[model samples]
Target: MSTITTIGFDADDTLWQNEQFFRQTEKHFATLLAEHAGGHDIEARLLEAERRNLAHYGFGIKGFTLSMIETALELSGGKVPPNVIREILDVGREMLSHPVETLPHVRETLEELAGAYRLVLITKGDLFDQERKLAQSGLGELFDAVEIVSDKTAATYQRIFTCHGDGPGRSMMVGNSLKSDVVPAIQAGGWGVYVPHDLTWVLEHADEPTAAPRFRRLEHLGELSALIERLGREG
Candidate 1:
């Protein structure tokens, strides 16, 4: 196997605290509409709304905000007050303005690997929002390049790996989501290292790779440097 020369990282949930904010916002939203629907019912409807709106609004806080509003309107039988709508918007604004909290060992791991490989950030979300987060994240300087894409797929990984590194086998993708980060990169012939997060968005959930040689799982980002070193040596 070709030696892994390029490293791609997923931003949200992987490098920083992301899903927790969404969960908190969801909790706040549920409380706002508790009269219209129970917590479970409201959460289910909001998730469905988010899924349906993905193609239309794409991904990001803006889309999530709209989905929450839509879910509120639907559950309230179009009777949701303007003040409630304003509160929902406020939730989104707060999320956008929230500080980017780096995950444990994220900065240190990136720093350790930065000089040895071409580090790339492969994240899917709103461009402006991603950019803002990157700016706020002190770890931005570690990434050689940043790609804020609309989505993650095998084709996308193939193109990115091919451009930045020798090819798929020579590149590795590290992330928290199996759906968006690991599976697609592995399918594209790149090695994928899964670093599980405490919380994951339901939409980004996917089954684990059963028996892939190039797929490895770790408990956290702190263990990533060792995994990469082992992979490099084994190759």
Candidate 2:
């Protein structure tokens, strides 16, 4: 409620339909390896592979596709057919080409807030894929600035908010991930708003921010305007 002036948003589940595509791709991948391993077993191995590959390839479709391939190879003991590899690549291509569907009330909420505050897109992912999503989303112009970073941390939030000339105290971050968007933002001295998504990547999970006075939780993006208005009044 400290007269929040600059607002930041995470792009993936907060604004658009991202995780669904990945989930679909993962399902298809598991089916392809059904002969080699059980669907659930393949899924478990894929998750482990993705976690292990994070440090090496970072995030996004490219890294995920590679992990799926590696998992397939491991599950099949290197006997996986060439055709299966081609299908895996095809799944990645399908994911990359999936339409960017904005979540309910995202545009309306952004439109309401755009004129009153400095709005920034503070998402972390691969450069090319993130950029592609931004371009496809058609909501890019609503953001005053866009940041497609490699990672999200307290220091990262502090630096971004500070560079925006507002510092973290007067800034706020809204998104679905408690780990990447809320906790780090609050730790950096900014207000953090959680807009829960129906689907979240396992790696992005974190405990709710009950200890932070500036933390706010909303059911959806549409409620953001009212929350901000109330915070402003409190300020």
Candidate 3:
């Protein structure tokens, strides 16, 4: 039998279309600020603001919107018109209300694994926004527990796994981010399954843990069930 008794999933690009919306909004934001700054400069400054404000705002559309506003103000020397800020707020509102689009194979994979193991949805973001996405995704019923956290770290995974399953040693965390989803879970002694998403946020990028014995990478979630079975057989 597989040593893994619990499976944790990341919500944002892992289960549904998320970053793409942010990307689209970013383009619109750039267009809105074209008179004030170049696209490349705006993008770089926005990323810097995001990195700097993470501790204060955490993560989600609200934080992202704040970062965009801050970026606009800085790039435009605090002279960006009020209408531009309004447009930015509208963009953020649109993102918050955007329909949740589940990625291919997500539903089927969750359905196949739900009965056999403890499944947890572990994602860090604005609680209201995360909850909204979860409710809209319609995948909430399949998970044994849901965690909307401020961040993902080794201690976070250890605590979650211990609360919801056998523990980190018997758990697996699967997601698109090698930084937030895979690395910390591995550090907590669980299997870290990296599922690459094409539109991953630049901030979430991390070097792959190719040397780790428990590290695994998948093209997509469709391959997850077979990989779990294979791991079980190996054990």
Candidate 4:
């Protein structure tokens, strides 16, 4: 069965817990707001601002910070005290400059799997931020190809697999989300494996598939290499 030659992976929550960091930052923001703002107005404003800004600016610390600033300006009605706005900006900047803390088993598993497989990383986010995380996590060196996509759909998966090769069923996709990672790959005629994430954003959570049965869920990345090896052997 040795059909698979390339294995695709989704970054962020799949490789590491991305949503946890943001959630931590959000907590800090809420704390800052409660201290400076009248009540929880800062928190509320930030939420509303995020909802509004998801369009103009996608994900990443930069967009998040910009939204925080926008929220501050609006909440203050242009009368925002300098200290309050500065505090928000400072927090946002800190998040941007923060180091990447990858989830457990990420580095070790990649080290083991990269040797036998053609690894590819497929992530969706602000190009710069995604690249920064990749570089920082030290996982970038393992992948033969790195793709920072704006979106992942069934069509997108087809294009990727076709470009890689059509004959070898050796290609597999591993990720955290059911919607973007599993369904798309399965629909594209490939294996779709899910590694459940402890923390992920609302947007990252995807709707269940309506058609083909292309979903395999795993608790951790450590279990993936064996599955891939078995598939490789079977093929």
Candidate 5:
């Protein structure tokens, strides 16, 4: 086994619950749209709106707002009320103001890892929202590099490797998201360590946990030191 060097992290649900808030807000928005937008099916419209927004706004609250507006107009058959936009924007901004609570053992694990490996945050979302969370978390200095992306795919990880000049031998990814953190990180030639969260989104699921040497997992960040020690001893 190769000794790991750089350690990458995923933001959002990995650090603290993020998707739950989005899910909540979406439900609220859907209800509002149903009433105001004239009986439009909330779930279907939301999916359509998200698909359209992904193409137009990429990812972020700005695009979300746009999608809300588009959905209202389309569903209402051009009967969108002015206040509808305000309501959605208010929700989006509220998302910005959402409380910042770090995950359990996150700080301690980070403190430990900081001494052993170069830390970087690689997350995908609206640039503005992601940046705000990063700033508010007060975790900026802990990460040697910070990457805000629109999406994380197999290609995204490899690109991150190139961007940061980190090869598999010297790099690892420790995060809660398996889809975004585990598979892509390994496919990109970096080791991945998953930390399962009590509350997590469904989108990050993987078919199965990646196997040893290339992949590892911990229930909490507290176990990180031991995992690293085991890997080190094997190497």
Candidate 6:
């Protein structure tokens, strides 16, 4: 039998439609600053602001909105009108209120695996916003436990897997971001399955670990069940 006892999943773009909304909002943001800056320049400055503010604001819609406002103020020489800021806030609110659309094969795949292994929803972001998304997803009950963390690191996976299952050695993490989900989970001595999403955020990008024995990649979640079965048989 396979030694793996727990299966962890990343939320955001992994399980549902997330980054697309952010992308859409970014386009709108650029439009709002059309007179002040070009789209490429605005995008670059916004990314810079986001990177700088991550330590203070953390993640999710609130942080993103703050970064957008900061970029607008800076790009517009501190003359960005109040109405623009108000529109930014409105877009942020729209993101928070947007319906959770689970990705293809997510539900059925989770259903297939849930009966055979412990499932944990491990994701990082604004606590309230993450909670809202999870509740809206209708996939909450599928998870044996839910961890909405400030970040994902090797230590984070080690602690979570140990607390929720046998240990990291016997756990697997599936997600879209190699930076936050795959690399750290593998470094924690667990299997890291990469499921690439077309709309993954730029900051979440990382080089793939193709030679790692515990690393795996899938074209989509629909392939996960067969991969797990193959692993089980390999043992």
- Weakest lDDT window of 10 consecutive positions for candidate 4: 161-170
Candidate 1 global TM-score: 0.98
* TM per candidate: 0.98, 0.98, 0.98, 0.83, 0.86, 0.98
Model 1, span 74-97: residue lDDT tens = 999999999999999999999989
Candidate 2 regions with alpha-carbon error over 4 angstroms: none
TM-score of 2: 0.98
Per-residue lDDT of candidate 4, residues 1-235 (tens digit): 4466778889888776677777887777666555457546776777778878877887677788888778767766777678877887887777666788887788888888776777888888788778888888888889888877767887777777667545225478888888788887887778888888877666567765545544567789889878776765765
Residue pair clashes in candidate 1: none
After superposition, which runs of candidate 6 have C-alpha atoms over 4 Å from their true positions?
none
**Residue 82 of model 3, lDDT score:** 97
Question: Over the stretch 1-235, how does candidate 6's per-residue lDDT look in tens digits?
Answer: 3488899999998899999999999999999999999999999999999999999999889999999999999999999999999999999999989999999999999999986899999999999989999999999988999999999999999999999999999999999999999999999999999999998889899999999899999999999999988898898
- Deviation of model 6 at 24, angstroms: 0.3
Q: Taking the tens digit of each residue's C-alpha lDDT, what string does model 3 give over 3-86?
A: 889999999999999999999998999999898879998899999999999999999999999999999999889998999999
Please report the TM-score between candidate 4 and the true structure: 0.83
Off by over 4 Å in 5: 36-40, 162-166, 198-205, 209-213
Misplaced by over 4 Å in model 1 are: none
The stretch of ten residues in a row with the least summed lDDT in candidate 5 is: 35-44
